[model samples]
Target: MSELVEIREDAPGGPAARALFDEYIELVRERLSLPADFEPPEHIFASADVFTGDGAAWLVIFDAAGEPIGCGGLRVLEPALGEIKRMFVSARARRGGHGRRLLRELERRAAAAGMERVRLLTTVVLHEACVLYATEGYREIDRIQPPAGPPEIWLEKPLYS
Candidate 1:
């Protein structure tokens, strides 16, 4: 059995965390065959940027090998709301309930941070992720075609009363 691990949020910008974040992005791009222009924003990857009063809080989950296999974050948009961004789980780690765990953890953290609800944007091409969010109680709020790309769907869920 693979050993589940607990990750600390204190070292959110450390080397291991950063490397895993990069790998997670790469996996998504490859698996989804996303357009070249669909890259993640650079601000989230820049340690200084993510922490500089920005709307981001990074989290990572490591596997038995002490490798980060999953990650996501709560981007505080307001005192009672947050945005979930960059959620990813490696192929090898899927079907093991890690994604659900990560999602729950993120929601808990957001609630602890005083957020009442959390939201996220995702592409239709990522069908699995969309289904996962829906199953986890995220309701679709909108779908819009951005100026530079395909249509994106917005989903939101309340984390607290």
Candidate 2:
């Protein structure tokens, strides 16, 4: 049977949030073939304060059995700019529209927070994510070589007309 999925907003760094973040990090590391010692930057694994503060939000998706399946977060970058961080859907949940749902919710929350634009960074290894962002109206900005992780493709979307 198909499971009912629910998305709920919550403070970051909680048990469920941390579990999802860890899963996301591990998946990225493995998918990008990063070394075992590699660690994601602090900004990507946001602290509770960041999500609870002004112009920020965290969302976690749970299945009908109350198992966490996916999560994403939005953080204010500037007065009218926000960033999408740590978006992930478990392997078991792939191809089921949960990622798209989480992304749309993040955009809606960002717009509700008065952000006119949103940006995100994903690696070349994450081709599915690149396609999703592009299909959702986010345009490629540039390529960035971050100090800690794999090379990334930067993307931005205008939230308002």
Candidate 3:
């Protein structure tokens, strides 16, 4: 089996990335059975904004064939706190260590940016993500029922000081 992986950081959010983002959004919407009128706002792409503005960094995993198989990113929420964002791996890519690779890259970038800690907000529906975070040294900070909809789980991990 040839090595089937690569990580990229300069990926931009043009038509291709936007299309992928939409596909991801559609999958989430279908899984959650969200209302038809519940389209996410443009600001939801703030993760991309942060990436472009240098306030965040994105890591994308590509298979040997040069197809994007997984992605994750980190946004600096405050001077010393980074927010992990948009972690996803295609179903076919699960259990292949892609997610973990993306996560480690995010952490490295956060540490390089001088962040002392990293955090992320996920929902109960994302059980796998919660498991990954917990396994990777993240601890629960709080749980909240936001005006948005579902119960939100917040987790944090300390980065290199």
Candidate 4:
């Protein structure tokens, strides 16, 4: 299964990226029970220039037939620190080990960019994503209760330790 997949570094604004990101956003919105027109703040959603410029990268995972199935990004928060942003795998691609593979690739990308530790924020509604992070060695550090909606979970993992 792993052998049939390929992870490639790419721009986050491409067609494949657009499709994957749209699917990901919709899934999160539905799980959180938000209205169709709801728009999360930029900080909570897309951070500007995150997958561009220095110390940041976006990746898309492709299946054997060359269709994008999963995507993720690494954005530097500070010196030697990066955040895992927009990690997602499509519904049809779940449980195929693609998420884990995509995450590992992102970690490699982070290390190459000189990051030592990585952090990510996820909503409690995303059970599968939370489980994937835990299984990938990300430990929960904080649970933040927003004024509304489910609590957001913050997790951290060190690339070197």
TM-score of every prediction relative to native:
0.79, 0.89, 0.85, 0.92
Q: What 10-residue stretch in candidate 3 is worst by lDDT?
A: 38-47
Error of 1 at 121 (Å): 1.1
> Which lDDT tens digits does candidate 3 get at residues 1-161?
13489888746565435645666677678767887656665433454767654558877777888777777778888889988877787666778777887898889888988889998878777777878888999999999876766677888999875
Global Cα lDDT for candidate 1 = 0.73
Model 4 gets an lDDT of 0.86
Better of 2 and 4 by lDDT: 4
In model 1, which runs have C-alpha deviations exceeding 4 angstroms? 10-13, 31-38, 41-48, 51-56, 147-149
| Candidate order by decreasing lDDT | 4, 2, 3, 1
> What's model 3's overall lDDT?
0.76
What is the alpha-carbon RMSD of candidate 3 to the true structure?
A: 2.6
Better of 1 and 3 by TM-score: 3
Off by over 4 Å in 3: 1-3, 41-47, 53-55, 147-149
Among the numbered candidates, top TM-score falls to 4
- Candidate 3 clashing pairs, residues 3+ apart or interchain: none
Question: What TM-score does structure 2 among the candidates reach?
Answer: 0.89
**Total backbone clashes of model 1?**
0
The Cα error of candidate 2 at residue 102, in Å, is: 0.9
Instruction: Count backbone overlaps in model 3.
Output: 0
Rank candidates, TM-score, best first: 4, 2, 3, 1
